[model samples]
Target: MPARYFTLEEANALLPELEPVMAELLARRAKVVRQRHKIAPILDDPHGDMGGAAATEMALDFVRITELVEQVQAFGCLLKDLNTGLLDFLSERDGREVYLCWRYGEPRIEYYHELHTGFTGRQRY
Candidate 1:
């Protein structure tokens, strides 16, 4: 299937939405790291009980954190791909004007013809 493409304006508008999602993902990663540090000291304490119910709870927490970290990483990667995949502008054949198209996941922007250069391209994606 052809990928869904966004206009330059549409893509630019999406940055606002993407930033928050990226921040949240980063925050989750930080939380996971902090949780890991907290659990590590507990595991290394030689004089404390480390093999009882508390250990099981810590293990479960670790598993949950790992899953969250993976999810956040995946989101970050997708954002990176989208950011890089988008096109800012392209010169038209006449050279008198340019067209803007975003191929975030579309087959191509050839179908979307623009009148001038920049984000004013037609929404043919």
Candidate 2:
């Protein structure tokens, strides 16, 4: 379990701040993917000139991705999937630990799942 846990209200309160970060995260991630595709062909060529702008931009994207990930973690939540914008916060449900799940576009946290289960196992909380 994570060192921090969040109550429903506390988790909901973070939504407003989280939304904008997620938007940027999603956009930056997409940009990185596209950048990677552009450079993939030359990646294995050790002699290929990778010092160009594309490589530099990709490196910057990766750095930004790391920064964004750390920002989310600083909020005491786990980023489960980038493609779906799934986030999980540690919380106790019933009698045991579970993840309070939130997906992109959802107004607030409305679901949870066991540690072993992922999105498909999410149940309304």
Q: Estimate each model's TM-score.
A: 0.36, 0.90
lDDT of 2: 0.90
Per-residue alpha-carbon lDDT of candidate 2 for residues 30-92, written as tens digits (9 for 90 to 100): 998887877987776889886478889889988998898889888999999999899999999
What TM-score quantifies how close candidate 2 is to the native fold?
Answer: 0.90
Question: What TM-score does model 1 achieve against the real structure?
Answer: 0.36
List, residue by residue over 14-124, the lDDT tens digit for candidate 1. Answer: 545444444544454455566667667767889777646656765675576456445534332222222234333433344433344444444334444554433444555
Error of 2 at 73 (Å): 0.1
In model 2, where do residues sit more than 4 Å from their true spots? 44-48
Candidate 1: lDDT of 10?
51
The worst-scoring run of ten residues by lDDT in candidate 2 lies at 42-51
Alpha-carbon deviation at 61 in model 2, angstroms:
0.5
Candidate 1: residue 90 Cα off by (Å)? 14
Best by lDDT: 2
| Superposed Cα deviation of residue 43, candidate 1 (Å) | 4.5
